[model samples]
Target: MSEAARHELPDLAAMAAFGARLAERLKVGDVIALEGGLGAGKTTLARGIIAALGYTSEVPSPTFTIIETYDAPPVRLPIVHADFYRLNDPAEVEEIGLDDYREGAAMIAEWPDHAGGFSHEAACLSILLETAKTGRIAIARGGGDWLGRMP
Candidate 1:
């Protein structure tokens, strides 16, 4: 079974703080699978993670381009930020060379289900966001590799 943790995102600031915590433990080959309905904070948390990674510029939504990459110096490590919302099929992931972009890098994947999902990976940290009466809730889960790493 996967390990799981819960977080309360009472506000954007809290969500961003959680992102920073998540970033501290990030490493190569890790995949942060973000899941939720539209406007449920998937992209918001992703932006937070990117920002915590040391990316100073704006993080445009990958809703159009599908994928965005950030390298070292600006970021502590290489990262592939992908939004699979535009993907018509899981096979499209291959066509776009998703694996190539993931080489030697961590990934922040939005709409991961559109790309066949990444939860199968031991290092894949899947975060499911749900809109709450007040703000939002984050449910994070992972495999053995994330046993003690679930933030």
Candidate 2:
């Protein structure tokens, strides 16, 4: 386990900027696990990442659909955005062909604990969001190329 570093984002724009920075460092097969309370901006951050990746369409929360796939232009690989808040068990993930999404995809999972454990030697980047007096606090943990660019 690695210690998380805290970042202060005074506003939504700052948070989105942080997300953009994170997107710049991501590659296929990367996994971002988000840990945050309701309305802590998990989806907001993800939206920023998708937009930064050149997705022009609206990026909606995957709460109902469970997962949304976006194809990376030119690269041809996919980005899997998942929300497992409604999951009853980790095993339920298998039913959705979650494993199939892992190959050549950057996965952003909100409520990743529902997946039990990451099967591959996936680069795990955990993001924890909290409410601070001035703004929101974004905490990141993990050792990877993208980790360094977080804060």
Candidate 3:
């Protein structure tokens, strides 16, 4: 059965730490769907993961570009950071060649619902982020790989 893990990030540092931890467990073909409203730290979390994986320089948001690809060596694994917020139709995901991007690469997708959702995938991890008085709350849920190593 699938399970959920909740984390309270009191600050940006805490969120980055959490992201780093999650990055350690990532593998090829894994999908991390980030769901949150504006300014919810989805991009921040993605930056943390990319940085932790050995990526240097800036991590750009895919808001306009739709998808940003990062390869190995600079990063330990190939990864794609994508945003579907601008998609007018769910079918637009096909135009972006999402499956091609996922081949031997982990994916971090924001506004996944706009891309028809990734939760049905057995290896998908859904992270719901929300603002709170203290900082931010992150709830992760899904099956496949993360079922055993969740915090």
Q: Give one digit per residue, the lDDT tens place, for model 2 in 1-151.
A: 3567788988989988988877887878778788788888888888888887778778989999999989868223478999998899999998999989878898889988877744234387888888888768988886454445544
lDDT of each: 0.91, 0.80, 0.90
Stretches of candidate 2 off by over 4 Å are 1-3, 74-77, 117-122, 143-151
Candidate 3 colliding pairs, count:
0
Per-residue alpha-carbon lDDT of model 1 for 1-151, expressed as tens digits? 3756899999999999999999999999999999999999988898999899899999998889999999997999899999999889999999999999999999999999999999889989999999998889999998667887779
Clashing pairs in 3: none
**Candidate 1 regions with alpha-carbon error over 4 angstroms:** none
Top TM-score model: 1
- Give the CA lDDT, 0 to 100, for residue 54 in model 2: 79
- Model 3 / residue 11 / CA error / Å: 0.3
Predicted model with the maximum lDDT: 1
TM-score of 3: 0.96
Residue 85 Cα positional deviation in candidate 1, in Å, after optimal superposition: 0.7
Every model's TM-score: 0.97, 0.88, 0.96
Note each model's CA RMSD in angstroms.
0.8, 2.4, 1.0
Q: How many residue pairs of model 1 clash at the backbone?
A: 0
